[model samples]
Target chain A: MLNAQVEPYQRLRENLSQRDRSLREKVMTLEEAASFVQDGMKVGIGGSTMSRTPMAMIWELVRQRRKNLSCSRAITSTDGDILFGSGVSDHIITSWFAQGILWGLSKVMRRHVEQGLARYEEWSHMAVGMRFRAGGMGVPFLPIRSMLGSDVMDQRPEAKQIDCPFTGEKLLLVPALNPDVALIHVQRCDAYGNAQIDGLQFMDIDLALAANRVILTTERIVSNDQIRRAPDQTKIPFFCVDAVVEVPYGSAPHECFGIYEPMLNHMEAYVAKVNSDPVEGMREYLERYFYEPKSWNEYLALIGMEEVLDASQKGRSIYND
Target chain B: MTDTTRYTAAEILAILSARQLKDGQVVFAGVGTPLLAATLAQRLRCPGLTILFEGGVVGAFVEPGKLPPSTNDQRCTKRANMVLGSADVLLLLQRGYVDIGFMGGAQIDQFGNLNSSFIGDPAAPKTRLPGTGGGNDISSLTNMIVAMKHEKRRFVEKVDFITSPGFIRGGTSRAESGLPAGGMFRVITELAIFGFDEKTRRMKVLALNPGVSRENVQDNTGFDLVFDEQIAITEPPTEHELETLRSIDPERMFI
Candidate 1:
């Protein structure tokens, strides 16, 4: 059977189309990567809450003055606040939105949504993931067991309840959430864009495949040989990655797993200032942390070497002190 | 010796909630009181208990001085047994793997229904809180222990919105509404501990904290609280428990 089809297969092969599967370089500067994002696009942020959130890329987007972007994350955090505060993203779809889970609810997020400056949509953690799962699988929606008897379904009209054809039990269907751009931060990535995450992967893998484009901000860009040394650690392959930018401490002030812990002083200061006053506090913060810094290094300098080392030591658990 | 007599409301909440966790049970815990309670349980009582965080860290280890600010905090994963993806961990919570869910929310009703969604009317919310993350799924699938401050505003007659269903209007309603399993097992607060009456599923006092008057609990509660004829008085925190708790949180951030 294999040998007989060779003549007809060649003609069919010539008619078939393909995307570039070659190992081409996908490196780009943060500014260049930020260009791939546009207004009104559904931007998927990788990472949960504070850990490994792509704050640097988000900061760059605000600096570039992108507007009307719809953002989604498995769990939202202070980045959600920045998006609303800067008017970079007018809508946020997330499972949880807070500066820190223990810091109480975000007054910044509350002020924006309550005042009608932005729209906030909430989904159960499972529903958010299932939406991404459906998006990655190219399905319209996925069946869920939760949100069956709650106000969450009532709020989001997109979610529908139906009887399962197989089990004849009730199930809630959540629509696929395919973002226009997925911003993922990784522990390391090769220049060819095989990204590796050292700790909890969260939903970034599904998000990378579901989005139209994947832009990765990495803590370090290692060689392909280094990436290949432990191929299993590379959760997102080069094929899935469209662009990669190596920016050390990319998740600074937010923990990057084995790299560094959250810079508590920076976070606390921001939270205090913002809680005291929303508009002016956010504006001053944007100027100081996002806009005024000429370079990423300058921003890091503002965070200071002392806090950096301290956060790093805390993250690595290097000492008793 | 640590002063056990003057334990704060947070300390009492953690202590009471921690006591409910049994050994070898798999607990799905959120940040704040839940994590602290589970950690205290692991340290003081249930060493076999496996604590998992919402953001996919399974068998999460809680360092004494470093209680994470969020479930997804890197500290939650330092010595974790497995770091699954978001879907995988949430699936575990959905499929009956988790035994007890430890959580905190904005409001809870007489029937133990929780509201983390909004405070005032949905049409015009006076204060909008963070919406349900995994609160729905966790509450739907496993027994839950709620830890909250005992205030008139918090112990509401009815939640503004049901972000997590408890006994849904009491009785067999939650099950009749097509939920598989799980319901609120205990409601631990600073004033008293409550559990659902098996018949009515309404909040009934299981125990009262020492020195808190019966009128005080009823006065602080928005709804009429059901109290047993022989309500047990909660013992004050032991010297050891106080010392350990203080040691765990030297800065007293969550203590």
Candidate 2:
């Protein structure tokens, strides 16, 4: 006879496959996954600026018209910039702001900041990532020596100065960044959410496990067998993932390691487009590239899969030069 | 054959910065000129140089003919030995594993403190440049080598803001300030190379770049500089060095 009084919350914590459950139903459409994001939630994004960023997820969030979102991360690529430029995000916590010297995509954010339309608080990469690390470990704060002599200590509200208990040396403490949701883009992920990132984790793994909810977007979706075969490659276990979305070329214009190289020409065009006129240019860009596309397949069709495949070939070749 | 080549100031700066790197040294390099210099060193001078990028690539063997757009560009990890998180890179810096931290800045004060945070008051007003990325992490923990274009505006008596620690008041004050004991070692500019004096910890001329006079260096600098007993002229870039550097960055994106 089943015990009818077994509390659901208690049963969930005591589940047998707590860490190794089959989360097949966790897979959802990009729009559905994006619905998990609420307005005014502090969001953390994966990847360094212009490198393997979660562009598709960001676009979905913007398309959904989620407003008043604030970003938390070590650095952002076009992800944070586009969000702020499109009026999706109003504030950001980061260190680096420049787009790649090759592509000045973040010029929009700069314009917004200079105009006082958006706000930003800066921290060194170490101090910023350490906050995510502390959050993942369920700690209140993490100690470091990096921001000791920088202006970041004075600006960041969470950055505190504390004396070492034993050594009596002054150290900087970065508080944990417990974001409401974390959006991460990776190279491959299984339906059950055992994900693998090929190159430069760059705080993604930390951000994935740290946030209250993790919505993972991937370049491709693989089977559970493939994930089990190389469990060691999995950076995020299924238990940590709240939902997953499969979107090919998810980090377009930004390279997904071992898949495609960042398209410098496309990025340059983006910068030029926005730089010509920040407000009108972005609206036109978003309309043409994001709003018009009804689905992921349509977006890729617009991007032309041949160009992507060629770039992928070049990226895979170690010495293409 | 002795190769004689007339190089631009940027090219000359890259070569001079490359020459400072020792074989088998671990270098933490930022983007722009520093990237060009570190790659030049790896290809031309130090084959054993291990390059670390704050974006998480370690022991990166940057591909020729395709200069990475940023330190974290996919090309940086293409031939990397290990791809780590930014936190791991900082841990390595904290452990004192990185030998040379090559960087560039908008403003550098007499004490070598760099300011890339903002141009005007902290509250508001004026220009807001990109704040320090790994500037604080690298400058605070490693022996730093700065590369910048020499101008009176960039070389200031005191920076508007100390975005990253240099000498911190030009004395034991840096150590006294509870820092982990690492600061600037060399300042490579387009016109001349500068170093910190051991006694007073002030900017001192180490070498003058080709065709640049002592007065040219002084006129461009915002602060008074100390001079070594004998400052040598910086060596002109050889044809091989120029060709190698050009091959890496054919477009001269940052040069």
Candidate 3:
């Protein structure tokens, strides 16, 4: 029989032990996490135009020649189209692409639809409103009047059309998006996986709630007690988290606060190279970054911090001291 | 006061420049002519006006003379208070926070319907340009909307696609649609300044540009260009307005 007097302390110790074990088992390298994403899986990414994204893992997936491993259904607020253009994704459900700079990226997406390589579903910003509302309400679907007479309805036949018995106005039904997995990057997390997103709260909050499982890559891992000390900032509670990988400079080439400056030169070079020779450029990138890495540290070493710093100084807008 | 008869871009600048602007006034600026007008309004007219770009930069400031290609131009980020996602901007508009919206269309009918979606045919088009880029929302919501375009075939008898609802058939349906009252108040063009009729809401030419005759304006337009009995030439730019507009944008005179 357990002693009642020591039960609370014993429970605390057990919780700590479980957290420690999970942290020990967390995948440190991008390649390891990339491997977890299988072929023909619908994936949800967390980002918007020129903001937070899991670029490292995406780059690794391309490098490893992870063929036949395509996202069956891809969803993002923005920037995911850039990934799709890089030959990473097949199908997509999104609003707009690059906000107009890369005009006809949507045209390319249409070509993919024409060739039957993938299916494309164009959503308005209203769809985002409906999805978030459904996720927050824990409902299966939400009714909205946005796509009533628009071409969006014809594109998404799966969306149920219902007549408003009261007004007789047609409303397009958007399905609740419960993603198979949500991969997010945050500023800080605890050993037990309670995460805090310091800067702009894009769609991370809703994404965390809507996804079936959450995998987080964070800048630092602290004690659970530290997170509890300041509960207001802890956006994602540990209960919802499936795994927490503490990767310093994890949002590298993308700004993660108190970590590293963004790799803007790298991003620009990537955009230019991809625009010039997409297939060959990606192949060269894979050979240079992934296959050549003897280990994770070797991979990290190849991206020199000094080079990033220099690039930042030379007119690249990266957050650094 | 007597010099209020010679029209120029600077005089047009003065009309927007005299208005008092509060902080956080969401100004949605369209491309080309409206871009100049809005930029001048911000720089010379109202410094506190928060310019919201269709490409998603909120409260962006242009560096003295540079006009960006689009709202998402890199310079826009460099000179912005905050860069919001396009989706977020649309959300803000839906909530009715946008104060003023500016738009231009290829064809605007007597009913205030704009056509920018297609050119020749819906099924098969001769020249299919970029369809409506958020003009639908911009024309619908903001407290007041300003329409600017060079009056021509682009400004036609009837638009091919109703990309935006201007006066939407008439005032009754427009008000019923929950659009703000005083719908589509003004239409500014290279040749004239027109206002919607009180009862019909059809565009009535109020003033003409200097050196532009009624016949020239009518000849260029596909529809019957309405005119007022007392239609006068617009006032020319003052030294202050001209200097300010020129200083802000030296390359083009959007008047």
- Give per-residue CA lDDT, model 2, range B1-255, as digits (tens): 112246777887788899999999999999888888999999987989999998898998877777778887778875678888888987899989999999987899888999988878877737777788899899999899999889899999998888888987887767766775678899998788889987678889999887788898999889999988899987778889988988888877887
Better of 2 and 3 by TM-score: 2
Provide DockQ values for all models, in the order shown: 0.69, 0.65, 0.14
State the fraction of real interface contacts model 3 keeps: 0.03
iRMSD for each candidate structure, in the order shown: 1.4, 1.7, 6.2
TM-score of each: 0.94, 0.93, 0.65
Between 2 and 3, whose DockQ is larger? 2
The candidate that achieves the highest TM-score relative to the unseen native structure: 1
> Candidate 1 lDDT, tens digit per residue, A1-52?
1322012323323322233436889888999999889988889999988889
Task: After superposing candidate 3 on the true structure, give the runs of residues whose Cα lies further than 4 Å from its correct spot.
Answer: A1-28, A64-78, A99-119, A158-173, A222-226, A246-307, A310-321, B1-43, B47-92, B95-97, B102-140, B143-255
**Residue A120, model 1: Cα distance from true site in angstroms:** 0.6
Give Cα distance to truth, residue A147, candidate 2, Å: 1.1
| After superposition, candidate 1 runs with Cα above 4 Å error | A1-21, A318-321, B1-5
Tens-digit lDDT track of model 3 for B1-255:
123454454345334323323455777776555565666677665777777775566777765465653443343443567755454665577677777777655667766666554456644544333444555556665543454445577667667665566776664666554444335666766566677887777777887765668887787677886788999887555567667767766765334
For the record, the alpha-carbon RMSD of candidate 1 to the native fold, in angstroms, is 5.7
Which residue pairs of candidate 1 clash? none
In order of listing, the candidates' clash counts read 0, 0, 1
